[model samples]
Target: MQHESASAMAGHARQHYQETEQEHISRSQSGFPDFEKDMPSLVNRFSFSLKDNLSSYLGSKNPFYSNVDPQKDYVWLLDNTAYQNRIGRWKAEIVAAYFVKNSGKDLSEVVGYIADKIGMAKDEKVEETIEQRIQPLLDSILPAHAVTIDLQGVDVRLGPSGRDGISTDEIAIPGHGYKDDQVITSQAVKADATTMRTHFASPKGWAVLSDIDDTIKKTLTASPIGILKTTFADEPEPIRGMPELYKHIVQKLDSPPFFYLSASPYNLYPFLRDFRETYYPSGTMILRDASWMNLAGFLSNLTQGTEAYKVDRIEKVHTWFPKRKFICIGDSTQTDPESYGEIYRRHPKWIGAIFIRKVTGVAEMDESTKNDPERFKKAFDDVPRNVWHVFEDPNELYTKVDALVQTAT
Candidate 1:
């Protein structure tokens, strides 16, 4: 019954307004509401009621209407939500005044207006960012180190070394003209470690250093402004299978033997935190510089083209944990291979292995490293055997290292 009555009342009000509008149009054809002269009596009758409803609605939405002392008839229903936004962004005085006057509470008194409006509560949802989420996870395994090896684009042509046709030395045989008196020079040969029987283990005080973009996560080619907006405003999407791997590394491997190294700038902390919260909530992070991108800095990329910022980070890790061995993992698409190779050469005992991700854009590894079992033995130079393995995906490494982590002290 109440719904029916309300419907009837609306219909009657519409009819009355149409009749009044038609009559007003016929008289002057101005199609305007001249409040000062026309409909003075009607205003006197309904103006108070209209003003009251508007004020009531606005007041319930916020406390700003309480301080407004305008005459009941003078009020107009205007949306002030965007006006407040404009006041902060464009600094328009008139728009700001309307928001201030119509709103009872001072704009300055509204704490967490942005977060509140967006429904992002710091304690509940928005607190965990990619950097913060990953930080503790990384910190728990704090002794991480990485080594990237670049093969210097060396060719892997196979066959015997030192041609057979070049004759220089004349030999004097003890038994002249004898059938077994001939002396010949042969090329050096060695066996690959993969075929050799050995007991393997992860060294003490070890951590894993890794590349960021394309190795563990997808790289979004964002500009500086885009990066800033993402860090300070937008959330990030995490890579598949990363959260579980991180948790396993933390809970299984534990702390002081695991860490992360990346070339991404430090300004991306917010995005990092966002990624972590969405996936690995307890992860740890270590970021690089907060400065603008420099073209000159990019020149340090060794083989697979990496950001030069990672070089400093890798060096820093070696300096901080000089005695700790780092099992480095990165993609062939960047300098992970070359840089890690350098690290292995410099500190053989401190670097356990260089695992390269076989990627499309990077240079292909030597065929001998891919095929011959013996050539692999001499490639490590002075480093320990089985310290270099190339993989297509980063996740594959956990399987090989799982035994080491399970038995770790």
Candidate 2:
């Protein structure tokens, strides 16, 4: 875990940033606006004034407040999964995000907004105090472009970040004789820069592709206000029995690699990453790429075009691990069933089992429709009923998971 000094890392990042700025300048001199390089800044500038005014008028430091410091920023390297390619080389996709620290303000304004949206805003000091505790969740994203990060302890060099302040690159690890599920962490070659862990998964074996909202954590995605409360106001709560069920999955599946795929945007990576570390097996989280500027985008990220987004990400995973049998797990609150079904149809043999949680009892949701077997049946149409199971409880999957192991044996 040894890393370069903070000064060294910061210098490297600055060099890259300058080089990228030069390129943007050249492009702009050619008579183009360089919109890709400038739009994020414009949006951030506008949003800052708007949020500041709103916060001032309301006299509250809200979750949506955007106070960015261009001079100070940090890199966040997301956890990734590596696999051995056909040429006997280990390869992994490195994803990183850049951001600046936000003003450490009470996020009670988020709770207040949610309360007002649902007509629940009141003088309940107890509830307000509870929501303020999650203030750490609010971080100002650095809308940086072309920021490069060097790595230590691995053979990977991430490309320059895009307009959204995220960079993704696929690099081949130069070594052999690595253990299966070997965990390798790449530290930033600078001080205080984020480090990422890559799990080396063998080319063949079992892997779990699970969802985040409502599958393992209580996200309440069916209701917009519930979504906001759980995401911004309240502490993340794991669905009952899911932590144990995931542990059982690890034991029965022989500690296979897990991929927690979600439709949530990448800004929530740290928050979701903490939740995963607390209750589930360590896995690479595949999240949406959009770095949204407003609170509305959060809800839209969960509900809009999610089926297509999940399908596309799963396809990328399939490309990386074509031989591995996958167990797909998701909930009924959104498009998990449809997304999983679409992938399963395309590669029937690649997927071994599909589990869909029959989400129910959440406020403001059409529970009867969500829990109806007909919906699952329609969603899984053209797929084998024996291959997919819908359940209300995590305990119901223990024997089913054991059965998959036996079938594989």
Candidate 3:
């Protein structure tokens, strides 16, 4: 029975991973230049045969891999980069699958191991060590950027609702009432884009609100149980350039963009803190609620709640930054695109631009997502404009963000 449960868990996990890949791919606007028409041929060129053998190592334990006694010499095999690479690649594949599946638990330390071993993310400590080494050197040369300037204080505040018209429950869902061409702009969107400004005493300040699962870091292996399993195994791979991306934002922030970390729930703040301490190293976080889970069972029976939670968060964001311009980053694996689109529609004035990491899968709309697809579509369709900026890799986003910052400056 134990083995059966574990096997069942593995199957569920694999499906989730594949779905994540699909959803991520779907939201992507660009990749491989002209490869879309030839995706089948392209995929055929990869070593997919590896999956048959890879599956066993990913889930089953061997005496060799379990032989380790200490945390420091955490090598699965001594002096065998090939074995390490194979394991890393396999782990990366599974974790990436997990991200889309949302199958895992919350074992931070183990997740950290899979993340590091698989190169899911760079060691957070490395960034701190480098910063400590480089701070004095950069401080000495700071005058090169401008006149003698001392980095001073920074403050950020989340604003409240500007104009309250309809009550939260006043919003209506589709099919149940409204027409095919029906619109709910009255209750959902602001009269115009909400206006919020991130004022800087200096020349530039920038903020980034990144998605947690697959964007900045990888806990993508899903399942709270899988997360628990991999906790002691290996570190998940970090999407390449994450550290540099955060660093660039930090460098730009000397002009002091009032940064705010906004995400779907308050629980995700620790991941953001990990980002800050390791890479950006400084910023403020605008926390949001995850209370939707409390109503998950109830909401799953109805379509109203999907948009309700997202709408609630956006309204909170607008209230907090009534006049601040901020950059938004989230994945397509969840409600990010629609959420950002609605925010852009209501307060086009406040949102500078949105960068959505397209992690693929419309789980919300999938039968497997445990929600009403029709309801999900209605909420998505109601958004004023498509606010998604999809990219295949972190590097693509870094290039675009560089341009946005330059233009903003």
lDDT of candidate 3 over 201-275, digit per residue (tens): 211234445544455655443332233223223343555666676666556534233333343233333444455
Which portions of model 1 miss their true places by more than 4 Å? 1-204, 220-235, 280-284, 290-308, 360-385, 406-409
Which candidate has the highest lDDT of all?
Answer: 2
Q: In model 3, which runs have C-alpha deviations exceeding 4 angstroms?
A: 1-206, 222-224, 227-237, 252-272, 286-311, 360-387, 406-409
Candidate 3 local lDDT, residue 228: 24
lDDT of 2 by residue, 1-409 (tens): 2232233245334433433332333333332233223211112312223333334322122333332233565667889998988976888888877555444242445556556654557858635643554332344433322233444344344534433445677877666787887897776643345667989898888999999989999876455555666775567899999999999999888899999999787867878998999999999999875544335545545655677778889999999999999999999876788889999999999999999988877665556766678878887899998999999888889889988986552
| lDDT (0 to 1) per candidate | 0.35, 0.68, 0.34
Please provide, for model 1 over 1-409, each residue's C-alpha lDDT reduced to its tens digit, 9 standing for 90 to 100: 1121232244334433433222333222222223113211111111122233233333223222222223211111101100012112211010001111122121111223223433454533443442233221111100011111111122111111001100111112111221111122111112110110111112244566766655566543222222222333344554455556656655545433334555553323445535544665222244542111111111111111233345555775565456556667675444456567667777777776676655443222233333333433343456555678776555776775665564333
Estimate candidate 2's alpha-carbon lDDT, on a 0 to 1 scale: 0.68
What's the candidate order when arranged by decreasing lDDT? 2, 1, 3
Judge candidate 1 against the unseen true structure and give its global Cα lDDT, from 0 to 1. Answer: 0.35
Candidate 2: where are CA atoms >4 Å away? 1-42, 45-71, 103-156
Q: Which ten residues in a row have the lowest lDDT in candidate 3?
A: 91-100
Winner on lDDT between 1 and 2 is 2
TM-score of 3: 0.39
Candidate 1, residue 211: lDDT: 65
lDDT of 3: 0.34
